[model samples]
Target chain A: MRTFFNTQMEVLNSELIKMGSLCEEMIELSIKALQEHQDFYKEILKLETQLDRQERNIQDLCMQILLQQQPVAGDLRKVYSALKIISDMERIGDMALDIAKIIKESPLEYQERLENMASATVEMVHLSIDCFIKQDLSIAHSVTQKDDVVDKLFYQIKQDVIAGLSKNSQESEVFINYLMIAKYFEKIADHSTNIAEWVEYSITGNYVGEEE
Target chain B: MRTFFNTQMEVLNSELIKMGSLCEEMIELSIKALQEHQDFYKEILKLETQLDRQERNIQDLCMQILLQQQPVAGDLRKVYSALKIISDMERIGDMALDIAKIIKESPLEYQERLENMASATVEMVHLSIDCFIKQDLSIAHSVTQKDDVVDKLFYQIKQDVIAGLSKNSQESEVFINYLMIAKYFEKIADHSTNIAEWVEYSITGNYVGEEE
Candidate 1:
């Protein structure tokens, strides 16, 4: 029984790592899609569907682990964290997919700051997953600091958009699209912050979702 | 043991119903805030915080129940459903709060259709919770239908905002704010649809998030 439980636990960990990697790939693909403001729907949609399947798979694994045998406190926390973190990660995928679909027909005037913001948000996703993989609180805490950079960049971009809005329908439309894309990136970072909190909770038995 | 488990389940059911009511109240208050275009921050903030606390309380109760006793298939589903539903509900609260904060300093041109959309979205929230309270799959199914109404309104408003953008910064800003607020209402409806799906899963043991 002990060996069987340990093996299942390892499977759970491995599956989450895979899902986390999928999230990173989706972010990268989304940024690439954003750079050209082109249609990457076929590839991006495949990743989004994979994300949903991955979430369901991990969900089933968690329920199986919980139902077959009673896990101790540590094992229980791990399962619970996987169950919670996948939703955040899945939302990250969905939002990135949303970013991909933005202004596909008519490419907007993309800002360099917007690309930097996406890069910053992507780093936060990477670090949060690494924290889960390595079980490191310091890495988990670092994701929070990185969120500050993303937020600052978002505000700057938002100010520029608001200030630059004009009576020209085409020009303002481009500005609005950029604003929406920036908000999506900001939200992606927020979801990463959520994963970091869940990682901290799984390791320490405490949760404080400090990202508002 | 069975009797104790049943009692705990009753407690769980009652707490969820309460949380569901808080969700309803938050939606209603947010709509009222939107119609008057006033800052309902204090009351809305209180409800949002209560939502977070309610989520934490229910989460603790779920972990307690899961840890203390071994539930069978049905009771286990009940716990899992509650765990999933609360996150969707809390997000509904958060999104409603986001709607409340839109264009507070500048009162935009209000659309009566937007109010109707908010009303329809609020009804969806009420009925989704009712499905959980009564374990009614029909009510759960109804939520999917209501989502169509919300979506239609959102698209109409989106088109109007897009077409109405002009060279005046103030004029287009209002339209953009209206667009953002409409999107928030659409998202609140989406979260309700998520709850409906969870309720369906809890009852029929099948999950289909068909609203998307």
Candidate 2:
């Protein structure tokens, strides 16, 4: 019975890690498609369907483990964490998809500031998934701190857009589109931070996001 | 033994439902304070600490149940679902607190259109929480359809802000503030949609948030 339970727990943990990898890949590929202005967004969109399917799959697997194995104590926490992490990962995937679609539809010229912000977000996503997969509390802690970096980048982009609006009204429409895209990117990183927080919770069994 | 497990499960369920009530009240009061520009902003800030405390209490209780009870299949699912739902509720609380702070620091001189968007979101939050409380699949299903309402409102706000930029640059800061706040409100609704979808999953044990 102990071996069976251990195997089931291992499967659940690996499955969640798989979902985490998918989320990271989608974010990276979507950004590359945008920055390169390639036709690769089609691929990103296709991957989004995979994200949707994987979300349901992970949730189902966690539910099955919780229902069939009747996970106890630490095992139960792992299953619960999988369920929450999957939801956050799914949203992170959606934000990436949204960014990819925006890039695909407009294919606009990228401003330097927007490019920097997008790149910073790409790095943030990479580090976030790394922390999740490694379960490195220090890496997770670093990801939390760098959330301010993404936020600062976002603030700079917003400021540039605001400044642009004052001097050049003709480009403001295009600017707003870029701004929304940047906002979406910031949100993607925010969701990644959320996943990292879940990783912390799974380890500590405490709600670390709140001031407790 | 079964009776002991059932009692623990019951406590977890009821506590989660109570936390849901706090989440609903926070979202509602925060929106009301913003829309009315009343002195309620201060009161809403006070509620944030209370909401955080409630979230901490529930998670601790969930930990106790999982550790001590070793509940079976159905009961374990109930406990795990409570944990997942409370996390969502806590995120919703964060969203509301974020919006309330935005309202306080930068008072909105004009927000009729933004208020309309918030009103739609207010409706969505109520319906979504109700779905969770009642475990009503119909309500949960309806929430998926209405997600686009918040999306549309977000788009409309973005367009209005961009247009306002060109038409009246003087109100640009105000418009941008409104845009960001609207975006936050839309996200709060998105988080609510997440809860409703999870409620669907919990009741039916079917992961069903995928676009179909």
Candidate 3:
């Protein structure tokens, strides 16, 4: 019985890791598409759907594992953390798709200022994923720190866009859309930081204090 | 043993209701403060903290019930639903506080426009809490439909404010803050709708498709 339980737990762990990898790949592909100005990237949508499916699958799998195994102590924490992490990952995928849509709909050269926003967001995504993979709570704490940077960048971009709108009020509609884009990027970073916070909590059983 | 088990489950159920009531009060008071401009009433941070503590406590209670009672089928669903509901409730409280702060800090008001937004949001809150108390899936689903109404109100208010801003751009900062207050109200409505969706899922085991 012990051997059976250990093997099943191993399988669950690997399945969770695979799901996390799927999330990471979706984020990476979305960022690449945005940076390269490739609006025609059909694969981003496919990856987004795949990520969503994986999230649902992982959640269902965790419930089954919990019911069947009734994992104790640290094992229970593992399943619980996976449940929360997958949720955050799914949201991150949604954020990626939102940015992809922005890229697809807008003129390729129009969102140049957003280039900085995407870069900051991608950096946050990478830091979050790294923290999860390594279970490094310090690195996870860092993800929260960088969220402020993303937010600051978002505000800076917003002001610049708003200023442009006020100068050429005719383009206010277009510029407002740009501000929304920046807002979306900032929200994505926020979700990624949320994931990293879960990593910290799962490993340390502590809420990562707000840095700012 | 059976009597002891049932009593324990009853206590858990009572705790769940208690936590839900606290969440409901937080939403109601937040609306009261925001709409009535009673900034002092926004000092419900203690309610948030208490809700958080209750959430964790009820979670623990649920876990203990699951182990001791070994709830089956419907009882199992009830326990798990309590767990999920606490999460949604905690977030709802957080958002309420966020909106409260907006109400507390902002000196500028949009006169009747702010009232319109508050009325829309509070109506949604009323409907959501009603659904929650009744466990009426239909009412819960209907809350999603009204988000668009709140959203339309948001845009109308925003347009009016922006036109007002055009008259005196210095007012743009205040109007944007006002816009955010409306947005936060909209978000609280959205979160309430989300709770409703969870209720539907608890009853039916599937999302009935949110009405936007």
Candidate 4:
């Protein structure tokens, strides 16, 4: 039974990694579509559906483990965190699709700062999942701290959009859409931060920055 | 043991309702802040913290029920749904605070269309939680359908902002801020839709709009 539980956990961890990679691909493809001015909406929508299935499968598996084995302490935390992390992963997929939709509608040339923001958010998603898979506390903490960079980039993008509006209000709609895209990226980073915080909770049983 | 489980479930249900009501209050306060151009940041922040603590307590209680009783079938689903719903509720609280933060920074006058959007979104939140508490499938479905109204209102607000910008390039920052607030309300409605979907899932074991 112990070995079986461990193997099930391994499967859970691997599935989570696969889902995380799907998120990374979706984010990359969305940005690529923007930078190259191509349509990736179909591909992103496909990935989003795949993520939903993955989330349901992982959720069922986690519930089965909890019901069958009734894991306690660290094991219970691991299962609980898996359940929480997948929701965030699924939201990240939705965020990518949102960006794809925006790009499809506007097809704006990617600004340098927006590209930087994209890369930063992608890195945060990657590292947060890595922290969970490896149970690396340091990496999880780093992901939390990295959210500040995304936040700063969002503000910079907002300022740029405002400046563009000030110069030529004709493109106000485009600027607002860009601002929305940046905000979505920031939100994706926030979800990554939530995953990282859950990772920390799984390891230390303490949610970072959570007040008593 | 059965009696004890029943009692614990009762406590869990009541706590969830309390948390849901807190979410409703937060949304109302956020809209009030915008309408009155008053500072509700402190109150919203306090509510956010309270929501967080409520989430922790409810989560712990759910975990206790699952571990102590090992509920299966419908009982298991109920506990799991509680866990998921609280996360969504916490996010609704965060969204309210996000709106409050924006209002604090910018203090844009409330437009009539925005007021309509706010009322629509608050109703969605209210109905979603009501569906969850009462386990009413029809009410849950209504909340899901009502999201379209909020979406339409958001687009209308967007168009108004754009028209305002075309007429006068100045105050573009304020218009953009209004746009962001409108977008936030749309997002809050989206979260409410999610809660409603989960409520349906808890009742029927079917996730509406979930493919395959």
DockQ of 4: 0.51
Instruction: Flag the better candidate by TM-score, 1 or 4.
Output: 4
Model 1 regions lying over 4 Å from their true place: A210-212, B210-212
Screening candidate 3 with a backbone cut-off below 3 angstroms (N, C-alpha, C), the clashing residue pairs are none
Q: Model 4, which residues run further than 4 Å from truth?
A: A209-212, B209-212
Report how far residue B209 has shifted in candidate 4, in Å.
Answer: 4.9
Lowest summed lDDT across 10 adjacent residues in model 4 chain A is found at A203-212
Pairs that collide in candidate 4 are none
C-alpha local distance difference test of each model: 0.83, 0.74, 0.68, 0.88
> Highest TM-score, which number?
4
After superposition, candidate 2 runs with Cα above 4 Å error: B38-42, B70-74
**Interface RMSD, candidate 4?**
4.5
Error of 4 at A172 (Å): 1.2
Order the candidate numbers by TM-score, best to worst: 4, 1, 2, 3
Candidate 3 off by > 4 Å: A1-4, A25-46, A100-117, A158-166, A207-212, B1-5, B37-42, B66-70, B111-117, B151-168, B207-212
**Candidate 2 global TM-score:** 0.88
Please tell me which model should have the higher TM-score, number 1 or number 2: 1
Per-residue lDDT value at B140 in model 4:
92
lDDT of 4 by residue, A1-212 (tens): 56988989898889989999998899889889978989899999999989998999898899899888888888888898888888888888998998999888887878999999999999999999899888999999999899999999999898888888888899877887888889999999999999999999999988664411
Q: Is candidate 1 or candidate 2 better by lDDT?
A: 1
